[model samples]
Target: MAGTIDPDAGISAAGEPITEAEALQRLRQSEDQSQQYYAAWWLGRNRSRHPEALPLLLATLRQRRPRDPGAGVEENAIARNAARALGKLGDAGAIPELLAALDDEDDGLREAAARSLGELQATEAVAVLLRRLASGPAGAGAPRLDSPRLQEPCEAMLEALGAIGIAEPGVITLIEPFTAHDRPLIRSAACRALLQLSGEARWAEPLMQLLDHPQLQVRRAALMDLGAVGWRPALEPICHTLAENSLKLIALRGLVEQGAHHDATIQAGAVLSAMDSLL
Candidate 1:
């Protein structure tokens, strides 16, 4: 008997049952806005298999046709999604286009570009991203949101630098000042980035103190970053935080993530008792 090939073998790794050539062609020629958007998005999501998607994505992003006055926000969605896709692709080849995108008029697009540069670990982009950071937080007066992830572009830039984790000679100096930024979220991101870059013993004490920041989001970010850095010296402060209902989940999660699980059940009971004593 002859060997049989699976009919679905043609599908790309991104789960689309189509050829890369076809997807790229559709992204270029499809007249339906929705189809074009999905095709561009697909190219990025499946970019590892289709390294050729970079040029097409860049071209799609460069197309800046003037929109009718009433087109509303959807007018920018295509380019924005393309920028996002480029970032997720993590190709250094896309760095030039992604750099250009950092100055894009749209806030969302600029953020997407900044985020992608970080994903690519584009060290050359550090200067530009830092410039954006220096430009200051865009949401200084905006209404408060519930999560640090909802931070403005400035905060996003700081977080990106942290994600890149490059310990350039001047990097710490630049980021350290932000630790005292007027905005608590920026302060939190700065602290997180600083820890990520150096993990110096000196940071342990200050990070422990920030656990008491007025904003819950700031405290949560501090806990998450502390755990990620595996700072075991923080076990005591983390245990104390577990007594507060609001901080308990993140504190416990941090402790487990840092491998402080010895007698965890007993420690958890002690934490709960501490909570009751405060009642």
Candidate 2:
């Protein structure tokens, strides 16, 4: 069931080759939903700094399709991708449109918007996101939702707060409880947020523990969370993660880069030497 739900939402054209101009045309005026998704993805994928891309992507946020109550996923895929594109575009101007997307009826759209809000580091969104997290995950623990595609985006919201770097006591108080969340992904996300927000190494413990998570996705998310937090103490633990070397390398590189700026104890020579084993 999990495999059935493609992240690209079944649009082969999402990968189809097209000129940048063509991508712009589709993103700007294409009536086709798939084209909209593809266009947003393409523009963001190339990091297109085109002036029109920002407004066009923001405009796509208003596109909505009828709710598919039976299948349970009602998000407008184009809008979700547009949200994702706005994040990659790295413009704070999209924050308003993304904040509006938080209230979208679709769980996936809210997730995308939350993630983009984080990527943009929209500090203003902290309060709104705090409220959203307070509402609880959209599809948690209810077997009836049958959303194998992982409906609850509570993790994304938590991660966004971390990226925004709000260290307020209230923010920490709100996010701390989620560190014990039943789901590994949420737990990792919470731990990562706590560590990033507070600069506390203790928060790194849970994420490192997840290096042993039974599920590959959970473990992968754990790896990402650790790298995002930039905790150099996790260096040795990250070296021992059971994930693929490609993933470990990415995480390790992130750790190395982060340690360069923040952790004086981090020895670049030793860190690169550790990668020798992976190589």
Q: Estimate each model's TM-score.
A: 0.62, 0.88
Clashing pairs in 1: none
lDDT of 2 by residue, 189-265 (tens): 88888988888778877788888888988878877777776677778888887888877777777688766655778
lDDT of 1 by residue, 156-246 (tens): 5766787788888677777777777766756766776776687676655666777777766666666665664545566567656533554
Local distance difference test values of all predictions, in order? 0.63, 0.77
How much is 154 displaced in model 1, in angstroms? 1.1
Name the runs in model 1 displaced over 4 angstroms. Answer: 1-26, 43-47, 64-70, 135-152, 201-279
Backbone collisions counted per model? 0, 0
Task: Work out how many backbone clashes candidate 2 has.
Answer: 0
Q: What is the lDDT of residue 153 in candidate 1?
A: 63
Candidate that would win on lDDT: 2
